[model samples]
Target: MPLLQRWRQAISKMSSASPSRFAVLVFTSIIFLWSLLLTLPISSADGTPTRYLDALFTAVSTICVTGLSTVDMSTHWSPFGNVVIFLGIEVGAIGVLTLASILGSVVTRKLGLRQRLIAASDGNALRLHRGAVSESQAVRLGEIGGMLATVALSLIIIETIIALFILPVFWASDLVTHWWDAVSYSFYYSASAFTNTGFAPNPGGVPEFADNGWFLGCLAAATFLGSLGFPVLFSLVRWARDRSKRPGVHVKLTLAATLVLFVLGALTLWLLESGNSDTFGSRTPIEGLLGGSFLSVMARSGGFSTIDIDAMNDSSLLVLDALMFVGGGSASTAGGIKVTTLAVLFLAAVAEARGSSDLQLFRRRIPHDVLRLAIAVALWGAMVVGVSSILVMSLSGAGMREAIFDTISAFATVGLSTGLTESTTPAAQLVLAVTMWLGRVGTVTMAAAVASSERKQLYRLPEERIIVG
Candidate 1:
């Protein structure tokens, strides 16, 4: 019970725990504390004080960068609470898992042996294989630091520029009274939309511009860019700088997958909503096309909307659900199973159809490890979304469709909602909180904590044949 004894016990426990697991635990704990602190009656607001569950939900949503909310963020929380939410968005965008690892390294002066081993196991860092290219711990850490700094600065600069362009428009339209208020609101919405954090200072989301073509287009572009993972963006940038060389496999695959999904999602929405008077009804052909295209892009990871999501036809809703579930790219600000994982799965499926022994993309064979990890991450993501949906439905008595929509939103860290979130019960809120947390950290990382204890098998087991559909 003594301070030294407590410190010793804490160190001993940490030493015994898997470093990745410890990192997740630490970050998760911090998020919970931060959420509780934000919910307390510590700031001045006009509306009712946010409940603990609501605050926690917002915190998890912000930290997970999932925008599902059980309370009206604009009405319930004060300026101080909004600031806390903004901080959470920044932290979540950078990834709490990596943040924890970085902090651990800073405190310890080096990564623990377990941490290095786990990083290697995850294939995030490369070890020398017969004198091949190898990275040192310092280089790895520097890469992470560089990536974070680049992303953080990019978000700030992009948001500032967007706010400047938007604030004047709002002022001209009389949507905002003062220059400062207009700037503040523009920055908040722009940051939220770009990060896919979905925390809006305006309750109805972007206000009168919700139906404006140019404004929606700008937001759609920003959201799309933000949702595309940092790795893909960096790779493309590098390839651009070196024009003779082709883009990396991940970047190429991400672009292809994004295009396919965007086209498919747009077509599905357009077709499904063509006859529905509520969404695409009686609109010009070009307008319909634009709306569908915007929805397709936004649904993937961005939560911005031009039309009310609640008014979409069932089929369109289902299509949006599927798109949200698939989510954005890996190593990016976006959530979900990632475009790379889905691309790998598609390639694997194609290979199976062709009776090929190896999965190939762009004439290059995919590594078995990469393929396996992709499948594992996808399966885990599906399971998390499925279970979370069930829990929400049972607790709140919301319909399956609404629950599924919210669950996908949470798991993908996309903040689009079908209006059920604000009325969700406390228990359902808690379940969603967990889903957002898991979605952000990723199921593989969480599963690794339990599976990490088992040593890697030295020998492969005999292959067994099984019947397939």
Candidate 2:
């Protein structure tokens, strides 16, 4: 009892001192707990205990919302294990601090300043630091309660609607002979899709529904919506009710970039794989288009793949690498450097080309700090991918393409793989698991969490411009 009290006091100190670190601690604790649960005999389909390594991998993948698995997901786990995964992903898809805040509200009957701060930090990493936020891009503190409600309500409503749409399709298909199985699988699919985890409960995985475009469409739609983050969803709901109000710059940029990437990725995949007999060559034009589009959406952190990824060309693999690395929006279930980060970088490049001094987007001036943050996030993400790719390559004796693809998939939390996940060494799998954890935990948040303190300079140093090509 004393030891438990000490642990609680330590956690409370950490939470009060650094919200980001507390979030990391909370997520890590959850992963460990889930890992222990999964290692139990009941968690396995055969009523035998699962390997600790495999259980740990699944726990990381599940909590990270990254679907890459070292084990056969459909056959290895029992109904109880699947339920554990479903619950884990829901806790994970909604930010850790946000979930805590929701529970705290339920227990206490109101959100205090600390709860709001922690929840806001979950939504925006800038809030984790002790300094002023550069811009008003993050949801305001007053709005955190509403945002928390939206997170819970949207997840339930959206997944329910998606499950309803998918239930009829499952009934019409011969995939599940039993109505009870269909009903269970319907909700499973909805949760998986809406959370962007892409873990199919059935044996065959997504290919079982390949010819069923409606089912695939429902999953794809849910995946896309899940990628759009809670802030955008809240703004979208408001805009829906009042047509006069437009979304903020962040929303506009996220939506526009997400749409553009989707279209571009879909077209690129369609063009590249159209002639590959293993992928899209035999399919009808519409079917190929659907396949391309679905894969593209999956690349944005969805993790579901209808077709075999190993059969695609190197060009297509590279395209997927880029898409996965860019990933979904900020504060979303989807991971990676985020679409907004990519947008900022591209906009910065364009501004430099046009000889502009300000980083302007949607008629708003983005502060220099936002660009700095974006650059830091991109560089940090690149470093993680690069180092992990090298490690995976060295440890697994895998080719550059396979190692890089799987590493990026893990790092971006996208879960789309080129058949390297299962064949790799346990050590390599562990590395990828860490990559997934890091990816799901925002790069900025991790940086702040690890740093001793946010340094404040009292004096300005003389600056000089350096020559560059």
User: How does candidate 2 fare on TM-score?
Assistant: 0.94
Q: Residue by residue across 1-469, what tens digits does model 1's lDDT show?
A: 8886676556435744655566577668868877787767753276545677777777788877878888777777777887888877877776544565555555556666443443333324222111233332212433454444556677788778777766766676665677776777878878787787766687566545756776777677777878776655655554567785456566677778988999999988988888888778768778888889988987887777767788888778899888988888665667888877788888889989999989887767776655666777888998998889989999999999889998888888888888888777788888888888888777537434434333556899999999989
TM-score per model over all chains: 0.87, 0.94
Query: Each model's RMSD to truth, in Å?
Result: 4.0, 2.4
Instruction: Quote the RMSD, in angstroms, for model 2.
Output: 2.4
Best by TM-score: 2
Q: Cα deviation in Å at residue 465, candidate 2?
A: 1.8
Instruction: State in Å the error of residue 335, model 2.
Output: 0.6
- Residue 350's lDDT in candidate 1: 92
